[model samples]
Target: MIRKSRVVLLVLAAVAAGVLLTAGFNVSPIARALLGDKEKPALIPAAAGLRMVPVDIPQLFKEVSPAVVNISTTQLMKFNHPQMRNPFGRQDPFDEFFNNFFGRMPKEQKRRSLGSGFIVSPDGYILTNNHVVEKADEVTVTLLDKEEFKAKVVGTDPKIDIALIKIETKKKLAYVALGDSDKLEVGEWVVAIGNPFGLGHTVTAGIVGAKGRIIGSGPYDDFIQTDASINPGNSGGPLFNLKGDVVGINTAIIQGGQGIGFATPIQLAKSVLDQLKDKGKVTRGWLGVYIQALTPETAESLGISGRRGALVSDVTSGGPAEKAGIRSGDVIVRFNGKEIGDEHELPQAVASTKPGKTVEVRLLRGGKETTVAVTIAEMGGELGKPAGGHDLSKNLGLTVQEITPEIAQRFDIENTKGVIVSGVEDGSPAEDAGFNVGDIIRQIDRRPVSNIAEFTKSAAKFKAGKTTLFLVERGEARILLTVKNK
Candidate 1:
């Protein structure tokens, strides 16, 4: 009986102790989730080895936004009929209504494309693309500080797709300095600040995907390709290096692709800007040669190990190359001491060179390397003889002309050759006959017509709706043609 009474006393004491312990501390949900009915204390979180500090992108925007200018163009275009126009492009019903009501409507289309530009000089000089201001009737410059000024087009080079402009403002405009684009490495961090989608001061971050990408934008296409999100209004904005210098001019992008964009290297822009500011016009060197890319078949035929370098299809008579003894079938391997990688690279190297400067041209002839010095001549000047004109133009859009003694000697054509038609009109009768320019006419209708008069008589028969046979000479080769008048 005493033992039972003692057990009851102990059980009551245990219950009281349990109640006191439960009152002292409650189990956290986190601890209860892991330990279930057995309540336990939660453990304190330990600090990680390293923590990434949050970056202040707004600081970058504030630093570079002052140097970037918002370029808005106003062009006077005469629109005839449509009341509400959709110039921005094909959009749905809402886009059409937005343009019709809010945007430039049925009135004369003073169509203008809004883009971005950056001041490269403290003196108010700016750099942009040629397409941005090419046909701009009036260009208005607006700053990030809400100031506007009229800008003048200083100089433009459409070939390289760069332009220089000056704004008449003495308000101490903020400008970005040009960086050395030649020293930029792939995967370097780049920031593009521009007004994209008409949104004000949009800045995007990316890395340079590649350098010297040929996007077929122009003759000189050594553009820096980036995965930067360049869009509609980012055309002329400054692509900044991490040092806050302008490394490139944000120019183009792949429309449907994400993050594929291109820019004009600041190095090329600097040279063009200097020339544009001083000379008002760009004078490019002329090599006077029609070149084509070497294909695999051409490489096999030439017994070349690799299909590279520009192939001289035709050399202009009395041009800089011809003056230096450069001839047809010669492959230009090097120009001005730089190796020619392909056909397009040759043009850029040649055109960028100064006129009247002698350049070393290394060419491959008969599997032998030949060296020649060519003094570049001015382009677009009228010479005494018709340089590109062939009698091909006169005879129904087919330019054909007698190969002069000089041309025959230059191109290595036989002196006793008939007038050659160099090009034929597409869908024209000559195209059906498979007649191309550079085909030397040797005989007509099986009758030997050496001179122009005899050739004219045979050609006249074809004019009266008759088929005429022609024996054409094509580079130490001959081809027969039976073309009937259509």
Candidate 2:
């Protein structure tokens, strides 16, 4: 009976296997399903993990290169050189005779240069670097299809090194959209298309190395640094992202350095593009104050906690800042509700504001925080010019000492008679008026200060709400500094 049972069981198992095969049921999967394991097989390779395939960038270039145009400029320049007539045409004894006989003559020369730019609109408005089109007698733009158009300068902001030019075209021209530079992250992939070294429409790829870099190019020196092989003639070209949106305008490169280049953020150009398009000029808001970065020493001296914010070195007389009660030695921590990270950020922030806009300025004064409302003034033609405002009382701003022989040697004052600045109260108006510890106060309101007594007498006559002019000698330069006693 046991042998018969074993044979029966083997036959049943064989029949069940045949049935499962005929029914197209995967036995292992069925077994797993029966065991309550229902997870599907993952596509990610277990051994190799995820893989990145190379992108087809040639298609990207074809789509975007049409907007990248070659810029050529011609300027009429005058040159002075000795013109010698080579009558013999070959080596001759009289070659020296003509060279010596000809005097210096002024001649007109045509200087032609090449650069790159991008179309920002279908109507043919283009953007480029100011240095590329500055003083250009004639500007010409060449498209990828070899079509050329004469361009005229719309406007230029030399402070940011950006320019706007326009060309006339009946047909709708291809253009690239400007991207948000603020959103671009460092290490993000980027591509640059430009006419580098006069080579037309070259494409190079790199990653954004950094942002908010100050290159000392201008007062507003925010630059985007990249490593996309930007070279000469690539200036004013477009630095695009994977989506073909222009995030930066290629502007400068480091000489003798590989993989180092700089671009102006597109957001900066876009901010002033409307003004450039409408009025052919950019007008910015001005808060008349001379500001410097607060170092740890300066911060400690001013009784501040951190080495952040911009230190007010001087304030302009009758300017918007003074009108707003912003004093020298006041550390500006915030402007328009935006925290000032450093000195460079303040200039850019202030310049971007519209004129006549009332903004709140938060500052740290005497270890306390205060807010002031200031109506910004029109920048006009004096964007970077410096003026003066000072505080007079010794405990308030500055102190004077008699110019003794030892003092002359210590302060390097050649003249031995005038009163010298002995101390400057931190954040004082006199300090804000650009008074240093060694500055010699030669005269006050045209009254010559020969000694400390004379300076004390003149300072005692300082009336509140009156502007006092101080004739100061600093490093061989005589300058008049104005102070308001308040």
Candidate 3:
């Protein structure tokens, strides 16, 4: 019986050994089965084809640091000294002698600032923020090799905060390749090279936190948010992707906020690069329309299904939009075949388009889609205001009068055919509707109100508890306001 039991044990041991070999030398499966343990699959499977590729950050920095540069600027600030006048209004002879000897107490002082930039061309055309070299009397660029060269300001766009500068160099310089910022995905790693705290050629690494961020810096506020340790001297530095391509320009940082930095996308810089190179400034296309975002409530009121377009609040008189038959209340869905996702998108799209190019504008009017061709116009200077006039609509708490020649001259108004708002009573319907003094009432409920008589006639037609649309010309822009009659 002992011999038989040994034979059976030997056979079981052989079977267990065979099982372990078949299971890729894993003894845990057999041991678990012997212990009556249940098996569980891995939470993350190895067969999912996911692999980690280590990045050589040092190698990348070495390759791209040659194109990065440190910028130093000097500006002269002059201050006028308050003159010590005699109580009897008599000139003191001693003051002139003191000023001549002391050189007017050093009226001017040199203000020096430091920033960063990157080379974009072989001939040494560098790109940096406008604020860096905006009012500087002198700008100097220093390369990684410690070679310095005086730079000339080629062009500057203050609205977008980009500046193009050039340095005279006989030798070809290294430049960074511009990448498509629109393709940069969130959470992807990015590298920033700049002169942070005057430490030239400083490099930092982080992932993109967000894109298309608006910090209210200017009209064009689209920025790439990153945590790449950008500082005051890092302004106008280059933000690079893994491929060593320039993706963004480091431009802003939140005060006292850790790891919060903003960059201007390379795409925006590219859009105006040629213009900046050739014309020394950027000329933007204008639509002459005041637009607002289509809110859910506004969309529903307009019988629209989705809030995906820009609601036109007003159209500028004699502007490109008005000439194209685009009216107030129209929702702009697309511009030049590009989809306008919101009100902000429309402005950027329109401004990027070359002026004098006629583009198709797709819009929704009263629940119906339509398209119009508009010839783009160059954006002009500011518009003039209108002077106050006599009272016309007392019930609406508005004081308006006809636009007279004297009033037009006083206010610099070119058009003298509309009714100008003189005053608005507090807490009244007109005041609540944003009726301001100097607003020229051109139309009421789609009817022309050329003068105070016409405005009075139109005001009498307002129904109690009903909303009425008013088209007013304020400065150079036109606006649409709605007032509920009480």
> Each prediction's Cα lDDT score?
0.74, 0.81, 0.85
Total backbone collisions for each predicted model: 12, 3, 0
lDDT by residue (tens digit), candidate 1, 184-223 = 9998777899988777788887788999998988767899
Global lDDT of model 2: 0.81
What TM-score quantifies how close candidate 1 is to the native fold? 0.65
lDDT of 3 by residue, 235-341 (tens): 99999987889999999999999988999999999999999999999999998888776766456546677988888877776788888999877899999999988
Model 3 clashing residue pairs (backbone): none
How accurate locally is residue 16 in candidate 2, as Cα lDDT from 0 to 100? 85
Clash number for candidate 2: 3
RMSD of candidate 2 to true structure, Å? 12.4
Superposed by TM-score, candidate 1 places the C-alpha of residue 202 at a distance from the truth, in angstroms, of 0.9
Clashing pairs in 2: 329-427, 391-429, 391-430
Candidate 2: segments with Cα more than 4 A from true spot: 1-54, 80-106, 383-486
Worst 10 residues of 2 by lDDT: 37-46
Q: Please rank every candidate by lDDT, starting with the best.
A: 3, 2, 1
